[model samples]
Target chain A: MAIEIVQCGALITAALLMIIGLVALVYLDNVLKKIIGAAFIGDGVNLLIIALGYRVNGIPYIFLQNMDVNSFLGQASYPLPFALVLTSIVIGASTLAVMLALAVVLYKRNGTLSATALLNDKKLGEENNE
Target chain B: MDGTIFIPLMVVIPIICAVLVNLLHEHSGVTKIFGYIGAICLPIVPILAVYGNHFFGGYQPLANGGLTVALPEAANAIISGSFLELFHPAITYAFGPGQQVILFVLGLVAMCAVFISIAETKKTSGVYLYMLFMLSAALMAFVLTDDIFNLYVFFEIAALVQVGLILVSRVRGNYETGLKYMLLGEVGGSFMLLGIALILGLTGNVNISDIVMMIHTGLVNPTNPVLLFAAGMLIYGWLYATGLPPFNAIKSEIYSKGLPSGSMLLQSFSVIACISIGLVIIRIFGYLPTAQMAMLAVSVIAMILGICMAMVQDDYKRIIAYLAVGELGYIGVGLGLATPLSITAGLFQAVNELVVTSFLFIGFGLVLYKTRTSKISKLGGLVEYMPVAALLTVLAGFAMAGVPPFNVFQSKYLLCQAAIAAGIPELAVIMIILSIVTFLAFLKMAYAIFLRPKPDELEVSSASVPKTTMAVMIVFLIICLIIGLFPGLVVDKLGVLALTAFAL
Candidate 1:
């Protein structure tokens, strides 16, 4: 029962991470903070995907020479979602790197990391473009 | 010697060429040859390859044979006849008539974009060409892949390549725009992934065909709230990808920021993404009238917002940008209608818009090339400088506005019929009014640029338009005319795909 609660808790944490990340991305004034917020969203997604593949007291998803097939099938927990999450993590990290690189460039050009200062313009008004 | 080998070649050739071109950036002559070689192959491979499925890693689906052959005997005995036996373990790419035509059009546009970009510059940057090729490859994957997760990977690739294309443009404030787009895109991308995860968690398979099969077989409940939520999330990503509604303003900004060459490719990407992702949505959620209605409602909103926004813009680039974004709604309308005829019309519109919008971008590109300004207030009387180009530009504008004897006309006529047939005549009326508004907006920009007297202060470049640009425009116009004259040549083939996918 306790383990089941922990498993469910992981899902709740994943949802909370996503919500907090989105709020930071939208409400934060600093551009760097917004990027960090984006990163948090990615981390949240990765966690959610991981939660899907989690198995309580399950064996590794590998076949052993002496193992019983039925037991393996019942106890091996899903490995597909883990493989998926791994790829997502790599893609997420690379994309975050690119975003950070762009943030650095924008800061150098405008000398400010504030989203308002960096993206403000006549064409890019707060109403829509921003 | 399998003919389907060309299917993978279609994507592989460009990727290999991207690397080659990137490495050979210092060698102008060598890069140009590689660039042309890769561009020519884009359309050719799709045409030559026979329609079939390619299973990556030779992992054929075990669904037909049951788990009896694939899984261990004990495991097979355990799940015996359950849905677990029907899961597809392989990555599949199915190429058919619809894919062939769509990829062919995308390749044509990409080829032209590459040709013009290389010709317009005295010394073309290999890095720019590499980005172009990579973007095309990603889009081709999106169009061809049967797995939704594969779609997400290529979606990210196309998005990143688009940012690289914009940053290379050196336009004022491009970096800022690029950063803004990326931030928003991260949100969209994450949600899309979450949706895919939900589908995986529910269905235990990422292959679209397998999921559809499970739902049809009554193995998975189609009315699950989680599935509905997933559909909603996927549609949000589709909106971002295709530049519909809330994303339209930024999507148009992306166009305005890109040079005409890159914008041409970018718009084509949105059109193709609309067809590919929209097809996935309908295939998965077609049973839900609410999902269909949602697509219809959002499309109507996009149409009104796009033209309204275009009408207020003085910069010709932004005007065309918004117009391009707005026209995407028509495609959504066709997809949203979820009927055989409507899907065909929607797809036909996608093909037509791909050609006409690129034509306009390249046409107006000449004005920018010659006058160094895209603002209508400062620009006037371009017809005198390049009569042939201006004439072609005007015709392209007419084509975009659904004028008769043009490609968009046939598609729009069908769309109206679809709206009426689907018991939504009000949508037909709205579309007709929006068509008129689209024409007027284009007319405003056209009259100002080509017919109005040249501005006293505007300095036009004495340099003539490039032959390559003119040649590419003439080719696109020919294609538009061909399709406009005999819509059957394309529509008949596309109808098969619509019938198969929209049969639900």
Candidate 2:
């Protein structure tokens, strides 16, 4: 009973973290803050995936020469989600790097990181054209 | 050719071309030749290949030895003793008639887009060509792969490639637009991952076929709260990826800011991804009326919002972008219906959209090419300078509005029939009304840009469009007419897809 509570608690915490990150992403106007928000979302998702694969009193998913297949499968934690998390982490890092690079470029060109400021400048350019 | 050999080749060829293009980045002459070959071959190989299931990693479960596994108590109650496995949990690609038809359209448009990029740009950059190839490969894999995780990976790669396509164009506000798109895309993608994780936790599988089988056999309860949450998350990802309502504003901005050739590929990505992911969702959750209704409502709202938004835009590119996004709703309506005929019509609409939208982008691209402007009010009397381009643009416009003897007309007609047959006459009526509004919107654009007197501030340059760009538009025009006249050629094959989907 206690173990089930811990697992459920971890899952709930992960979901809460994701919601908070999403709030920052949508509500925050600063581009840098948005990027951090994206990273937080990634971390929250990774945690959720890891939590899903967790097994109480389970060993790492490794094979030994003498071990039987059934016993090993029953005693070991699931490895697929862990492998998936590794790939997702790499993808997240690369996306973050690209986002930050674009932010740097935006800052250089418009001299502001605020999305609203950028929109204002665009609107101003349109008005000038008209 | 063997199914396994050719299935992987469809994805591999373009990837290899991207690498080669990057290596020869400084040699424009060599890279251009490579791009043409790569583009032409991507479509042909898929058409010639036989259709069947192809397994990778040499992991055929039946051939290795079918393993009998005991089911959990709940699953045991629904089925007999043990489950017999036929395929291993390896990367599987399913090639059917539907995949072939869609891939062919994607390939053709990609080829034309690549050719136009080479012809229109001042200097062809190898990295740009590389991004184009990578984007094409990612889209093809998105359509062809049977593994859910593989789809997610391709989705991420396609998003990054979209950003690359935007950044390399060097437009004024492109960096900002690309940043916003990437940030939102990351959040959406994480939601999709969470959804996939939920499914994996429930089914212990990532292969889509296996999950569907398990769900169908009642191993995974469709009514479970966790599964419902997963479905909701996946639907969120679908809406984001396809640029439905809230995402439509930013997506249209991305399209307007991108180069015309880039927009051509961007629209293709949107069409193909919507069909691919939408089909996956329906395959898994079609039993739930709420899920189907949610799709229907979103698509209907997309149609209303997209056309309404297009009606108010002054920029020519932004207008077309909104229209392109609006057309996506028609495809959505087809998928949302979930009937055999409706799914087929939806798939056909997807094919017609890829060609028609690209034709419009290229036709309008010629305007931007000659006049160096996208604002409609500042431009006028283009037909006097470029009559051929003007004619092609009108034809593409008419096709977009579902005028007779154009490709979209057939699909739109079929969609109406399917909707009414499915007991949704209001949807058919709404579709007709919105299409007329779309036609009027195009007319407004046409009169302002082509028929009105040339503005004093606007300089009508005498520089003619390149022969190659015009040739590409003419080819697309011919394709539209051919498909419009005889929709059976594609629809028959699409029927096979619908039947297969029904069987599943």
Candidate 3:
């Protein structure tokens, strides 16, 4: 009973974190904060994946020469999701790095990080060209 | 060559060339040679290879290897042994006529785009060539991979390369657009990952074929709310990736800001991603009526909204971008119809859209190259100076608007027929109206830029049009005419893919 409650708690927490991150991503204006929001979303997803693989007092998914296949399969937690999350985290980090690089470039060119200011500048430039 | 050898080579050669080009960044001559070689070889290799199952890491399906379980008495008290054994999953890539057709179009476009980029630019940077190769390679992988996780990885790579393509173009407003696209892509990708996790939890496999089998065997419940949520999440990623409605705003901006060659590759990504991911969704969740309905509704919205938005754009690039997004809706409708013929038409539209859009981008690119502007309002009477370009542009434009005797028209006709046969005549009506609207929109731009008297501010004498550019445009126009005349040459292969998708 206790183990089931703990599993549910972890799942709920992961969902809440994801919701918060999404809110920040959609509502926030600052480029840097939006990037942070992206990271939060990645972390939230990572946590969710990890929670999916969790088992009560589960053993690590490893094999020993002497261990029987049945015992290993019964006791070990699922390892596929863990592997997937690890790759997901790496991809997320690379994406975050690229986003930050673009942000730096935007700041250098426009002298601002706010999306609204950038849009205004574009509008003004278009009008000038016309 | 063996299936394993050539299948991976189709993806790897471009990547290797990208690295080689980047290393030879200072040697323009050498990079040009390497670029040409890579571009020419990408399509040829795929065409030469025989289609079959190519398993990454050499693991076969569970049916090939029988299962066995062994349990020790000591550990039995703590846990049950029934769940311990699982099939070792391998990344399975099924190469068939469908992948071959898509890869062929991608390769041809990439080749032409790279050749055009090399000829047009004064100083060809290796990094630029690198991004082009990376983008094409990622797209090739996107269409070829059968593993869900592998698809996600390639999808991210394609996204980054898209940003790189924009950043390297040195266009104004590209940086902000790239950032916005990246942020949204990140959110969409995370949701897709969450969805994949749910599917994995339920099915215990990432191989798409295995998951399909599991679902078919009733191991995974199709009607589960959790599965429905997964479907929704995957659909969100699909919309963002393919530039469907709501995501179309930033997507059009990305296209407009890119170098025309880059835009060619970018639109290819959108088409291939739509086919690949859209098929995946239909494969996994076609059992649900809501899923199909959702796709149909979104597609109609994209068609209506894209044409309307396109009609109002002053920039030629933005106009093409929105129209391109609108064309994606036709493909979506075909997929959403879920009939074998409709799906075949959808895949056929994907191929046509790839070639036709690239042709249009290159045609308009000639204008940008000569005039140094994409704004339709600032230019006039280009036909007098560049008659060949104006002619080809009109042809490509007609193709896009689904005029008869063009590539898009046949596929759009099939789509209409499929929709009506599927008992949804309204979809056909809406599609016809949108195509007409698109035709008018393109006609207006055509008149404004190509036929009107030359404005004083626009200098026609200084415009230097390259022979190579004209040659590439003619080649694309010829290809379009061939396919438009004989779509059966490609549609037969696509029919097999459609049947396979429906069977699953």
Q: Measured against the native two-chain assembly using Cα atoms, what DockQ does each of the candidate structures obtain, in the order listed?
A: 0.49, 0.48, 0.48
Per-candidate count of clashing residue pairs (backbone under 3 Å): 0, 0, 2
- Residues B160-265 of candidate 1 have per-residue lDDT tens digits of 9899999999877788888888988899899999999999989888999888887777778999999999999999899999989889988998998898889998
Worst 10 residues of 1 chain B by lDDT: B61-70
Which residue pairs come into collision in candidate 1?
Answer: none
lDDT of 1 at A111: 89
**C-alpha TM-scores of all predictions:** 0.97, 0.95, 0.94
| Per-model RMSD to reference | 2.2, 3.2, 3.2
Tens-place lDDT digits, model 1, residues A4-80: 77879889999998999999999999998999998888888888888888888788899999999888888998998
**By TM-score, how accurate is candidate 1?**
0.97
| Candidate 1 positional error at B425, Å | 1.1
List iRMS (one decimal) for every candidate: 4.0, 4.6, 4.0
Q: Considering only N, C-alpha and C atoms within 3 Å, which residue pairs clash in candidate 2?
A: none
| Residue pairs in candidate 3 whose N, alpha carbon or C atoms collide under 3 angstroms | A70-B70, A73-B84
- Top candidate when judged by lDDT against the true structure: 1
